[model samples]
Target: MIRLHHCHETRSMRSLWLLNELDLEFELQIHPFDKSLRSPEYLSLNPAGRVPALEIEGDVVFESGAITELLCERHSPDRLGRNPQDPDRPDWLTWVHFAETVSQHSAALTQQHIALYDDAMRSPIVMKLEAARLGKCFEAIEGRLSTPVENRDYLLTSGFSAADISVGQAVYMARHFVRLEAFPELAKWYDRITERPSFAASLPPEGAELLYKRDFYEVWNG
Candidate 1:
């Protein structure tokens, strides 16, 4: 049996979207994104107390990237994952993991904008810096997408894969803090990937509590 611990609009959304894309049967355990994660029971599943502790065949997987790799290997190898022998393997790995690079800034911005309720507890400088950093990540993606290639709708030359899902979900979160307007290629790519039914299914269910309340969180100017 496969089970995934998830929280609304967090990194776990990447794993959830991948699972949906793979058409895997798994149980979803929604956890409140708060101290409940730090509880001993939850910590046992993920020492870091992060969302997305996946249980498969009696083994638990932590980290979204690791979960994405394992799931693709077990279920969608060659389709969502390129084996080591494949030329695109290196690029696949790079893009799959790059999701976290984008997410780290989102995570920090989430903390600054959402977690800290009080204005004094939030740092305007940190918010601006992190949002600017997210723009850099978007620029990197824009460069990749802009590379001269025929039918370059996805990250990999082969086709759509977990790399798209991983980075797409990360962009989903990052977009709240940083607009995609400046990067036209990235914006178009994001819209294309997110239109997939699987991506839509990964969204938090109706009435479900959300980590990000606002559609956009503009950086504080103070």
Candidate 2:
């Protein structure tokens, strides 16, 4: 049996989307995104105490990127993943992992804007810095989408794959901190990928606890 440990709108959403796209039958164990993650029970699944601890065939996997690679390798190698022999393999790996690059900034901004309970506990400088970094990541994606390649609708030339899912989810989180209006290509790509049924299914269910309560968190200048 395959079971996915998830928290609404967290990095784990990437794995959730992939599972939906692959049409895999797996049970989802939702956890509150708080100190509970560090509880011994959850830690047993992911020693790192993070979201997206997948149990498959009695073995567990942690880290969103690692899980994405393994799932695609085992279930959808040709479509969601590229074999080492495939020319797009390197690019695929790059884009797939780059999701973390985008998420790190979002994680920091999340802490600054939402996790901290008081204004004094939050750092305006850190908020602005992290949000700016997210913009830089958006610029990188814009460059990729704007590449002169014949059809750059997705990250990989071959077609839509786990790379888009990974980065798309990261963008989903990052958008709460940084707007996508400036990057037209990135915005269009995001809209296109998010329209997929799998992506839609990955969204947090109605009345579910959400890590991001607001649609947008403006960067503080103070």
Candidate 3:
């Protein structure tokens, strides 16, 4: 069985969601943030001290994006991945990479506003500027999703894929930092993704304490 070193409230949630989507049984080892991920034991598994590290056949794998790909390859290869032999492989690979890249930028902006920037650095002006930049990213997504209702569903090809899992999680996190209401198409897309059984299951129960808690610089001031 695969062993997942999961940290609550982090990108690790994506791994768990993906595993649940695949219906693969795996061991989950919770690594609470208060416990210090840099501990020698955790470091032995991932020198970077990140969570959602997977131990498969005694080999450790880190990075949420990579782990999602690995799980798809191992368990739900048919559904999660495109056939390399297919002529559409290029488009499939492009969408996969696009999901990761766009989501990274979106998540980075959130971290900047919520955790990385201080009060002196995060003025209203700065916040608006950052919001505008993030808005442009959503605009791009909105354009793609503007396709006719029947053709607008998934981020990847016709059906659900890892792209949806990755991009969906990033968009979910974006709500905490950016106002997504301006983009109707993106908002609709987000609503659909969040309603998925896998996505809904991944979220913590309402009012429940987060799995892992980190000190957000902005939260301290407010």
Candidates in order have lDDT scores of 0.94, 0.94, 0.68
Per residue, candidate 3 scores C-alpha lDDT tens digits across 1-222 of 698887655677778778778877788887665548989988898898877689988788998767866777777666876566755456556655555555565455555555554656545555555556666777777877786657667765467777677777766655555667788888887888778788777776676567324332122222
Clashes of each: 0, 0, 1
lDDT of 2 by residue, 87-124 (tens): 99999999999999999999999889888888888888
Superior candidate under TM-score, 1 versus 3: 1
- Candidate 2 residues lying further than 4 Å off, grouped into runs, are none
TM-score of 1: 0.98
Supply the TM-score for candidate 3: 0.80
Poorest 10 consecutive residues of model 1 by lDDT? 213-222
